[model samples]
Target: MAADKVPGMARIAVIGAGMGAMATAARLAVAGHRVVVYERAATYGGAVRRFERDGFAFDTGPGLLPLPAVYRDLFVKTGKQPLEECVELVQVDPSSRHLFADGTQMSLPNASRAGVVAALDEALGAGAGERWGDFLVRAREAWDRTRRPLLEEPLWPNWSVLADREPYPSVPHKKLLRTRRATTLAEVAAWELRDPRLTALLENHALAYGLDPRTAPAGAAVLPYMEHAFGTWYVRGGIGELARAMYERCLARRVEFRFDASVARIAEKNGRAAGVELDDGTVEDADFVVAGVAPGVLDGLVPGTALRGADEVPPQRGASSRLTVLLALRGGRPEEAAHRTVVHTPDREDELSRLFGERPGLPAAPTVTVSRPDDPALVPDAEHEAATLTVTVPSGLPVSESAVERVLGVAERALPGLRDRLLWHEVRTPADIAEATGVDGGAVPAPALAAADGRLLHPSNSTRVPGLFAVGGWAHPGGGLPHSGMSGALVAGLIVEGPEFRGSQ
Candidate 1:
């Protein structure tokens, strides 16, 4: 059915004030819909939160933004001002500095494949660059094959096509007088990359997203390709600035926002979503409802409303959650330091085993990402610096004080004298994530991938109910800054252009 034939202007009730929800609300309002966002919290941005103390600020959610073009398109489609006008986007040069177990360190240039290859060769040895560069070529092929189906379009009826097909064109490797193609990411790393350090670099991409490289499909190669191709970015102040900009854009488009309003249930009438029932005993009627929440949360919102698509929802039992430590240093940040630094764990197998093992525990040597932005906005003065350290741990695992210390120990590799310079530190655990994002177990959702036993696939954006839609990281296209932003575009397209809409051209 065409949008014009569906009905008049719709009264859209969004369940959350997250980036995806706000993005959808802005687009739907631009399409002549009456949009209202009801957020259980007193603020917008969901997990995109910030921490401030004694004039030092730190981003507790995503430290950087990737594929900023997602938001660029959103601003272009909704209003006159582009995203650049709303926020200051700075490309992080030397995309990241990596510290390997062998004490080999290298800083890679932003979005430069050749430069990355050269840096690896210079740091790791001769022939290393060629191997990594060759792997990237195969990765690019996988990206070309799966980009549209996985990121651009909605989850199709025959999603098994994606589930069954391995898009990565893995070169045949001969071992023990047998030839076979790599299926898992670890296999690709060992068979193609061939160096422990190179394998670590390749696997780190998957590990960061909560995927176990040993089991993540070879198609997971797209993760590194997407980042290396698009480059990493930072919003001045913090990533939360992007959220504030998105919320502001929604208000400018006449989208109403109600804070501290919890949705009790989704109202259904005649097999369609009619509106929402608030916990405060109020019923707000709407022609359409958009939900930006986790799958478990959605299940409770509409009791007895069976979810459509997918046989079983992926469990969060072994999913990964982040542990962030915010440090307020009493010294100025060095001018020559890279914006981001990754300290690789010495023992990859042991770390992965601990993280994904039956009884998850902190790795003896955990891989840690340290972010130290030079922007003065994050510090009070030249004498103070704000830094954030992050590590991936099994979701719902009890994080002990020692676990927090272990993360700081790994981070100290990037920041020498970290303890001496620190005035005070704040720890944000999975419990904090659960409270902030309302995702039980605080499991951070990973981006959707083509293969891997369908463990990486998310639910369809369109639900079983006629007028209800899912629009967030937990929905189709999955998580990360770019994916969530795209979810908004996809949901808006399906609602405004009709169910027949495939995706944005």
Candidate 2:
């Protein structure tokens, strides 16, 4: 309930209580404004929402946690304790495992570039480590140069911001793309080193992010930096705990919470966004509104003209699809492996080619990600364990019992004894994802950026509609938990400091 005692103050409405909305509310409240957030789900946190079923907890979306500083920034700026106080982070070394058909298994390190190179040398061969160092230095530079212009800020008309000031007319934008995607990571490794296993192992990451390395941008190499530098982490209880933490913070800030309130339309007046109208005939109004929802959803809700050149916002790239099987196990599995594993066959190159790029159907065998809920809070006790195994498949795969059995057959071939280990399980398909999130065609917001048209990837925070702002996966700092949280804060900062903010009444 808003404090009526605090008289004469402007009320700010943040639509969607996901990471973006929660982050926005925390910052806006600290800026001395009255803020109320309306969420369309049973609880706060949109795609970031989590749920517990029969003692098994699952994050609705976003299973991996990386980049901790973004969260630290959100809390410190809001005059709250850091995330460490909320959740304990454990680094999973040999960050990921890869099994090849030749019966060779390679695990990548959760160490620095140098450390990663050393590990590669030890795992693959001698000189391979040094080449990795050289590659990483280039990757780091690319990340430094583009992090702000491309990922953080909206990248539309403001493309000029990426301009260079000297005799060398800035890194030719094409060069960046050519460098990242010119040769697939697979091809690059094959050329740099003699080990086919290493090349195929390195190249497979393309499919992980829903891109084909051959066609995916070189900017992708930056992905290793965060994972190797900061180390992959898990929320205390489950990935969902992060969402709950952000939700708690929102409550403390006195942000209004409305669940099961689906937004049907964005209210606009005189070419300006006034507020949002919920599906059940309830109208919530505010001076300024920040939408933390997905862009495709926005495309449907807002007036097409409200977003300048909305038509130009490239149509959705069919998102990467996944066949997720959640398991409730009697006891923990082998402790020898890290929290995550990547199992492959000897013919990994062809297999990965099919997985990462255009493939006819699901791979005869799919790469599997096995994660046991290491966070105790997610499970009842040490005797009971919950884990999820995910296999990336082409989007729009059929989700029938027979189709599921076919995939499971492949999983059995890889794990050899996977079926006997399962106590109980649940399977989620791309269709399930689409129905749950309401993103157009259920495409997960893995923005595939190409140098030629990377500008279309992130548009500026200003939605062109006066008094309106956009946040979350569709806005700056693309997808991922940390990025979204930081984006929420950034959006709020823009509104509070920008000319649009209407101070307390």
Global lDDT scores for all candidate models = 0.90, 0.64
Tens-place lDDT per residue, model 1, 1-505, is 2222235588889999998999899999998899999999999998899988899999999989999999999999999999999999999998999999999999989999889989989999999999988988999999999888888998887887888899999999998999999999999999998999899999999999999999999999999999888989999989999999999999999999999999999998878888999998899998889999988888899998787644543433346899899999998999999999999999998999988888688898799999999799999999988999999988877788888888888888999999899899999988899998899878898899987767788888888888899988898899899999999998998888777889877
Query: What does candidate 2's lDDT look like per residue over 366-474, in tens digits?
Result: 6666665456676766676676677666666666676566556655543456677667778887777666666654555554243523432555556767767777766
> Worst 10-residue stretch by lDDT in candidate 2?
164-173
Question: How do all models score by TM-score?
Answer: 0.98, 0.86
TM-score of model 2 vs. true structure = 0.86
Highest lDDT, which number? Answer: 1
Superposed by TM-score, candidate 1 places the C-alpha of residue 147 at a distance from the truth, in angstroms, of: 1.0
Error of 2 at 238 (Å): 0.9
